[model samples]
Target: MIDKILNIKELNYASSLNGDNLKQKIEDLFERPAISFFGNFTSQTEFAAYDKLSVISWYVPNFKRKSAYLKGEILKSGKGTLIKLNIRPNTMLSVASIVSVLVGIIILIAAGSSTRFLIVGSFFILVGILYYSFGIFSRNRLRTNFEKTLDLHKV
Candidate 1:
């Protein structure tokens, strides 16, 4: 429900690689870490199966939280393969930010005549906007990375 509102990006691509080959290629891009708790801060792709691909940036320590995951599905087509991709915002993060803003607004409404409440509530809204904006920016960056790595023409 929240994901539907958080600007999901979708695209179609024409890939020459078959399902198995495409899976292998995307698998090569995933982090092969040995005894690592926190995964790569940089964006990387992983395959849940031959038909599914996930792009993630885990534990990226920064002001802008990387909160978007690129999810994709591969289908075998007559020519080669078709890739359907979606950049989805993190559900947990989105819900938390929205709830935080809502709580702030509720506080302001309850304290009808308080200027302090107004300031605090406005700050919450501002923070929520900033956080969501970073997620949007990260979405674009992830899209670019996926397109480049796949090297597929848009269909």
Candidate 2:
């Protein structure tokens, strides 16, 4: 589900394609079909992010990890173009992880004579931390990727 639709003002696609073609190209570039399309000069996508702002949406291969869905639109303006995007995070997994850690803590507190409970709780805590760390790692990776995708200004 889309959570936040970002507004990108005065964007320059530097392309000559008509509105429909340009919208299709944008969706194709994102690899996700858009959910809606507007007037002769407007279109909307259910999932798309600027190559930079979408850093947090990157996916990692793990059962604990989750996917983020996005939605937005592109419209022709006076000189450039206007873009509106909604980025949503699959926070259920993270919330579940937090719950797991809490469960683990409770198990430990009540696991007086059971090593199994202690181990299980510890495992939950470790997994929670690891999954959370992966999110951070992916976001940092996005930053680097974004920079590489853009030409650096000459000093």
lDDT of 2 by residue, 1-155 (tens): 12111111112233344456656665454453332211122234233442232324657565323233334455566644444433333454355556767877888898898999889888988876665554444433433332233321211
lDDT agreement with native, every candidate: 0.61, 0.45
Q: Pick the candidate with the highest TM-score.
A: 1
- Model 2, TM vs. native: 0.45
lDDT of 1 by residue, 63-125 (tens): 323355666777787988887777755554555667777877887787688899888888887
In model 1, the clashing pairs are: none
TM per candidate: 0.66, 0.45
Evaluate residue 14 in candidate 1 and report its C-alpha lDDT on the 0 to 100 scale.
Answer: 90
Question: All predictions: root-mean-square deviation over Cα?
Answer: 7.4, 9.6
Candidate 2 has its poorest 10 consecutive residues by lDDT at 1-10
Candidate 2: give the clashing pairs.
4-86, 4-87, 5-85, 5-86, 6-85, 46-70, 71-86
TM-score for candidate 1, residues paired by index: 0.66
